[model samples]
Target: MTDFITTELHTARCLLRPWRTEDIPLVPPIADTRAISWNTSLKFPHPYGEEAARTMVSWSQADAGVDKWQFAVFKDGQLIGGCGTIRGEDVHAHTAVVGYWLGVDWWGRGIASEILAALVDYMREETDIEQLTATCFGWNPASRRVLEKAGFRNEGVRKGVVKKWGKTTDLWVYGMLL
Candidate 1:
């Protein structure tokens, strides 16, 4: 049997845990929002549905030997969003790229910052990663602020690197050294 690192992380106001099969239904509405997808990677479909959510949950559960960690964000026992890290391999093995998104209802509440801070601390303490990085769309100031407040420093911008909503935009990179 493969040993999997399935763990739950907690913050002052939220719990970050693995996605459950029952959580599939809650994902579609929150993840399908245009506002959430605008700042996320292209892999996050705009019209997220049960199938996508199921695929996500399944993929997250499966261990293919890579150091990828994903968790569903929960507040007051309710699923609010998701966050995770894609750890690099070989020469970049000490680094990982983190990403997160919250439902519209949870915006402006400092939940994102809290989630990142907790996840960063957990990764540093529990894993071998030395650096955590994140990318935010140039048009999304809220995400940028969240990363900043979580102690990530602005690295630089990649011009015209992402095409979303029929427009090509720059991506601001940020990194935190653990």
Candidate 2:
């Protein structure tokens, strides 16, 4: 529960750093795809616009430096996606839920898997979190694969856990206990 400096996290393909005010404009274009929103939680809305971008950036900026757990993913100086961790409180404070997304153009390039593995390692080595978890829509096999490749084990599945786009779906939960 004490502060630990995070600075920037890096993978072979990209850099994960704190969000900036300038990134607000760049998010809408990359995040406005139904394909991306379909697999993610409702928090990431389809037709993602400037207002949503502003909210995302504000959340990242509100936290302390390097310690800002949310990160903007950049490759070659351009924003390509984003990732972050949400730590649980109370009895689950040692656990953190992880999430990430890449632009459609960045898909099939293994960027998410690469950055995700790195993020897990960073959190394990740099922070107080001891358990990391991620959940994907059961129909999203690609995301399930990414989580597996990053060393997460499928914990279980919860049926009727997510209602998105007017359809109810199962949620596949994955976790890594460090």
Candidate 3:
């Protein structure tokens, strides 16, 4: 199993903490939009609801502050987004995949950029991971921008590798070494 470094981190305008059961009630209202799910991942489908939130929170609750790296992003004590890492095992144990998402209402405020930078700094300082990776669909320039602003390099792209919403799209991969 992979080990995580910390449970909580703070950016200038957000507080990132481990997921809580209480957050189950807050997730759907912010995460159920097609706009978010379409660009994020298949795991987070449109119309995401309490059950998905329960699973996400439960997956992190037991491992919070110790083993799991995913965090719930909060602004002024309200759940606004999430950011975290998934560490690789076996020969890739020194690397991790990073991801983050925010509610639609909060877009374009530099929040994700700030949070991503802070998460990268935290991982570099607190974990054994040597490399960090992030990916965005070809249509997601906003996500690409966030990753680039966090000092990640556009390592490469895989054309037509992602099929989402019945359409094939490219995948842009970014990486940073700590």
Candidate 4:
């Protein structure tokens, strides 16, 4: 198991905190209403209601003591999204994968970018990690742009790389060296 660093991070208009039970109310709608599940690896039952939220919160806390780090993104004092770093093998432990999504209503407001910036800075200051990577569906230009604005460079695309919602899709890889 890998160890993770946890901290409260702030952005110009948002606050990023560890997940809590209070976040359940926001997760379902955000997960269900938005087209968010299409481009990411979230399970189909996302916005997974109260029971799922409880399980996730508990799982996240347990993972934190090892290698996974997840944070709830808040704006106006309300949970609006989430961000996290997932650990890989020991040889690549100094590196992490990044993933996040915001509520559909919050789109185009630069919230994801704000959270990404904070996450990057937090990793640089709090860990030995020197690189962060992200992957997006080939069709998600908006997500590609977010990564670019956050200082990630496009590496390349892998053909038929992901099978989401029962169909195979290509994936674009992005990377940022800290």
Candidate 5:
């Protein structure tokens, strides 16, 4: 297996780097917001607590140098959110699924777009990945805009593919080739 090194990526306003145990305390409060959780995968707990934050930090640390690349998004030296890519296996090994989320307080500021563009560039330069894919809830136009701004194109939507928080939602798929 090839060993990969995790490094910090900087944008104009944000810093993307590997998560530290110290970051656990900053996660739950930002992640627990309903606005943030509803647009993300179900794995992101809505009632996100200290335990969940600890688990995530631990998992992120363990996944370092592996196929999973998770980064803590920091702005002004404060942990504000995260973004990552999980590589596919077997015949799909060249592909990766990207995901990201920001604190509700940081929404509508183009932070997500900047972070995503930097992440995409980092992946292209550091890895052999061929394609990156992302999905957004159909109702989340902001996320769609972010993906598009980062050069991902809309593929299609899976109708009512996710049933979360007592509601069924469509999943809008987006992809980019590197």
Candidate 6:
């Protein structure tokens, strides 16, 4: 995957693009705060600082070609959240893991679904990736619905696969094949 053909991506209400320094301040607290911690795989104690965001921006840039990317999800000219793919080492292979999260305040407004849909379209058109996979805690019905609505099919549970806040969690695996 030389790149995901990221010239531009547009959803009905959002735009996805590369991250910038300006977006740092907006992203940290959302990850640090307890509001969205459990819903994401982001490491905890996000520190709400510039360093982390810079690191992320750098990674997104350096890894852009191989299916690793971080697109800033925006609406109304504001940073709403971030979404991207964690490209597998095999570029010619048609697959990658997808992950994303919105600010707590932005939840339940169809934003996540919209973003996911746009990403799916972009991936299908921009790369040879035939499979996009995602995981969500079993108890998180909202996330499950979002993935299903985005055309992901439920696979199975990975029991006790994630440990957050000192508790083990079972994750439901889902995938969409193009």
Let me know the TM-score candidate 1 reaches against the reference structure: 0.92
TM-score of each: 0.92, 0.93, 0.93, 0.88, 0.95, 0.88
Model 6 root mean square deviation, Cα atoms: 2.4
Q: For residues 1-178, what per-residue lDDT tens digits would candidate 2 score against the true structure?
A: 3343346877887998877888999999899999999989888998899999998888777754333478899999899999888888789888888999999999989999999987887787878888998999977999999999999999999998989888998999999998
Per-residue accuracy of model 6 over 1-178 as CA lDDT, tens digit each: 3344345678889998877666777777665566676667664244446677777776777757455756889889878788888766656356889988887778999999999998888778777677889989866899999999999999999998878767788999998887
Q: Over the stretch 1-178, how does candidate 4's per-residue lDDT look in tens digits? A: 1234346888999988878766776677666753877767764355457676667677677757346678988888878888888766779987889988887888888888889999888777776677899999987889998999999999999999887667887899999998
- Which sections of candidate 5 miss by over 4 Å? 1-6
RMSD of 3: 2.5
Candidate 1: C-alpha lDDT: 0.86
Candidate 6, after superposition: displacement of residue 136 in Å?
Answer: 0.8
Note the residue pairs that clash in candidate 3: none
Model 5: per-residue Cα lDDT over 14-90, one tens digit each: 99998888888999878988888889887888789999899888887775756788899999988899999988999
Model 4 TM-score, all chains together: 0.88
Which pairs clash in the backbone of model 1? none
Pairing residues by index, what is the TM-score of model 5?
Answer: 0.95
- Which structure is stronger by TM-score: 3 or 5? 5
- Candidate lDDT scores, in order, read 0.86, 0.86, 0.86, 0.79, 0.89, 0.78
Cα lDDT for residue 102, candidate 1: 94
The TM-score of candidate 6 is 0.88
Candidate 2: the clashing residue pairs are none
> Per-residue lDDT tens digits of candidate 3, residues 39-131?
978888778989999988887666453444788999998899898888777888789899999999999999999999888988888777799
Runs off by more than 4 Å, candidate 3:
1-6, 62-67
